[model samples]
Target: MAPSLVAVDQLTVDVITDNVSDTYASKPPFAVSELANIMQAGAQEISGTTLLVANLGYGLRLTTRQGSKEHVLLFDTGTEGAAFLRNCRNLALDLGTVEEVAITHGHWDHMGALEAAVGAIVARRGQGNVTVNVNPGMFNERGVLLQNGTIFPAARVPTPAQLEAWGARVSNDGDARLLLDGHFYYSGEIPRVTSFETGREDHLCRRDNSEEWRPDPYLMDERMLVVNVRDLGLIVFSACSHAGIVNVCTEVRRLFPDIPIHAVMAACISAA
Candidate 1:
């Protein structure tokens, strides 16, 4: 079946997890607590110390409302269930409303809280079908080889069966598609076409348990999400753009030449 191309009426993004934090809210937008007050979330905890602690991971809770229909998509879980779940609770977010989960890559920091998130969703859904936007390339062991020739093992992500057991309908594919009635555009395997856009160095992976790590710079499983807002044009969500942010943006332009990219929500930019 073909994916939908309809633009959403409104898009609201909540950074569920990320490496950098701005709880101080010294700028135009105050902290989540103050924002909650503006949002009328009085029941939630609002304290100086109750704010969420930033982690070396990325997760975004996005809600796109088109007319009367509203949908939620969890883009990548944080380092672990504990941190992400805690933040969700503190924020008083309704995980039950999430219908889809999109993973960006196979790194542990990006997918560690997947099981906990699925469990929460199923608990609220009560046998509900939550579609997980994923690809088969993420189900293997991955690592980074340091300059010392030592392999830094990464925490393995949940297997397909494990995700299914946690009540997830895995949508593993190689081509891009739209989710929630075209509210989101999920990119397939990103091609490394840029000459200067070099990928992560020392990125290695092992297929079998006994196999050794090999150079796997372009993580074939890495994908991105694009939400076309009514007036905002396109909001590209590239969490851990291992394939290169420039390449990701270029693809967006190629796909939608008519629309202008108003904003780009990228993650894991500390190294850069």
Candidate 2:
């Protein structure tokens, strides 16, 4: 059965990490720019240090409010710990308020800073206060084959044990479920049905160090996040869309056939 998603009155998405910092880009009335957020956070001078770091990764701090209640959750952790933490500090984000951390996939760029992020949350919220949502398929060794026939291995995300030791209650389940009291829906695994929306052709992965690199083009482990906003419909957040954005939206529509999709946030293309 589809989960009964709760409607939130408002949602705020802070781009904690991304590949670009578009301070001058024209945005909707509901959106804010990097410079505005930084200055609001008390930046006197707009230097390289005061600005948020742009990297080859993605992360978002999602906050939702319904009536008198508000919930905070993390969608991803970006590529590195220092940059992720630095952005958090620069934006004056309170990691302590994060009730849950849902990783969109096992890619290093998304889960690279798992340890540091969880540690920061645990330091403020205390042990076992936050839950880290993940799935089993995200723990494999991944890489990409180069033109010269050599495989460039990507850094593996922190193990489940590492997350537990860092004071996180890891919900390592593979099935779709509601998160943070139904304010968010963490998908199980995206089904690829689009003909032209094929996945990455160079992706490779293996179970362990001894296993040979096998084709992982589909990235079957990738998942997406969804939120139902009051009067606005659905807001979908697909971190990298290795499963394809069309397929992601298809899944969303299938799950909530009556709800109109308000918007979709995805790192579908890399400009860097």
Candidate 3:
């Protein structure tokens, strides 16, 4: 059965870090660009210092409201600390209010600034005040195959113990459950069922230093964060969509067949 979810009156997604920062492009009424956000945060003029840094990574600050109550969650933390921290500062976000964090996958691009972020949060909220959600499968060392046929290992995400040591209450269990008073649905292992949406063959991983590198194209550890908004429906947030957005949406559909999917916010790659 689908887990019970609280219907939020509104949802706001703040893009703290991403691959691009195109503020001049046309956007929907419900959408705001980087420049607008910076200016709204009291930027006098649009300059290098005033603008948010764009990096080869992704991160989002999700804020949801249900009547008078509000909840905030962090999804991923981008590829590094400097860029992520700079962007957050430019946006004037108060990480202290963040109640939980949900890492979409094990990729460094999605979790590189995790320690820095947790430090910021814990600095204001105090030790062990925030919860970071993750699964055990994501702790393995991952790499990519280069064109020359050599493996280029990626930076590993911090261990659960490291996160705990850094003042975050790490939830390392692999279970689909409601989070932050049911305002968000943190999915478990996403099932891959799409035909053409096969994962990247260059991806590889090793359980430990003793284990040999093996193909890890399908990142089963990848999960999606879903928010049920009042009158609108589900707003799914997939970090890299390494599990394939189709499979991600399919799993959401299967989970809540009665709810309509309002939108999917993520970095989508074309299968074709």
Writing each residue's lDDT as its tens digit, candidate 2 over 30-101 gives 888898898999889989999999898899999999998899999999989999999998899999999999
Tens-place lDDT digits, model 3, residues 156-225: 8899999999999999999888998899999988888889788989999999889999999888898899
lDDT per residue for candidate 1 within 126-171, as digits (tens), equals: 6547988788889779888999989988888898888888888888
- List the candidate 3 regions with Cα displacement exceeding 4 Å: 1-3, 270-272
By the TM-score metric, which is better: model 1 or model 2? 2
The residue pairs that clash in candidate 2, if any, are none
Question: Where does candidate 1 stray beyond 4 Å?
Answer: 1-3, 25-40, 43-49, 269-272
Better of 1 and 3 by TM-score: 3
Q: Give all candidates' CA lDDT scores.
A: 0.81, 0.89, 0.90
Tell me the TM-score of model 3. 0.97
* Candidate 1: clashing pairs of residues: none
Q: How badly does each model clash, as a count of residue pairs?
A: 0, 0, 0
